[model samples]
Target: MGSSKAPSWSDQWGTGGLGSDNYEYEEGDKLKKSSSSNKMSSAKAAASAGMDKAKSAALVSADKAKSAAVVGAQKVKTGTFAGLKWFKNQYQKRSSK
Candidate 1:
């Protein structure tokens, strides 16, 4: 009767080492990213810039509204003072007569 030889470790696993040799990769190498990732980064940057612009515009609009309110208040005060002066002048003229 002939004695059959057992298979070696390399023959049972593979010659390339881990799994298959079809995949090409190296240790410590950065992983390749798809174009979609780059596109998303660009979109995020644009959105951030847009938000900054909107915030600046809102601040400017608020400042303008505050200035307008101050000017309107000044006008009302000036008009009331002028009316009081006119009334006092008329009363003095009538008493002297």
Candidate 2:
């Protein structure tokens, strides 16, 4: 990786992992004191991220369960109607014979 002053491999492909432009941000002295968002502790940040991940996983599971239930209901309805139709056809043939 080249210095931020010099363009690097990241910038060549447009990924931009290279560090900041300003001197204060590079020093890490300005943003923490200035911004409210930067005040969160590392532990709190990790916990919040974990909660967010769990919430996302739960929602995805709920969506999958709902979809599965719908498919199951459709299958049951179709199967029941098909069974009834087959029974009626067999009964009709037997009566004609």
Candidate 3:
């Protein structure tokens, strides 16, 4: 038997190797994905769903923030314009005396 290299991190994690090197199958051999791969894909889908939820929540928060900012700015602008109008009226009344 050929002397094999010492098992590295893959052996420690029981994943065989960094990539799908062990998963590759030669032609004419019956090959099918392992249940572990299926589990991994399902986990990936769950992670994606969570990420999508986060993304939607962030978008909702941004929209709310934008709405609040626009409402606040409108209030400030309206108040400033009205105050200026009142000031002009007061000055006119005093000068016309």
- Model-by-model lDDT, in order? 0.70, 0.66, 0.74
Q: After superposition, how far is residue 6 of candidate 2 from its true place, in Å?
A: 56
Query: Which residue pairs in candidate 3 have backbone atoms (N, alpha carbon, C) closer than 3 angstroms, thus clashing?
Result: none
Write one digit per residue (lDDT tens) for candidate 3, span 1-97: 3555543455434555435544533365423344487778888999999999999999999999999999999999999999999999999999999
Residue by residue across 1-97, what tens digits does model 1's lDDT show?
2443433345345654334333233454322223456667888999999999999999999999999999999999999999999999999999999
Q: Which candidate do you rate higher for TM-score, 1 or 2? A: 2
Poorly placed runs, candidate 2 (over 4 Å): 1-40
* Model 2 lDDT per residue over 1-97, tens place: 3434543455433432324321123353222213334444665898999999999999999999999999999999999999999999999999999
Q: lDDT-based ranking, best first?
A: 3, 1, 2
Which 10-residue span in candidate 2 carries the lowest summed lDDT? 15-24
**Which residue ranges in model 3 land beyond 4 Å of their true spot?**
1-36
Best by TM-score: 3
Relative to the true structure, candidate 1 has a C-alpha RMSD (angstroms) of: 15.7
RMSD in Å for all candidates: 15.7, 7.9, 7.1
C-alpha TM-score for every candidate = 0.54, 0.55, 0.60
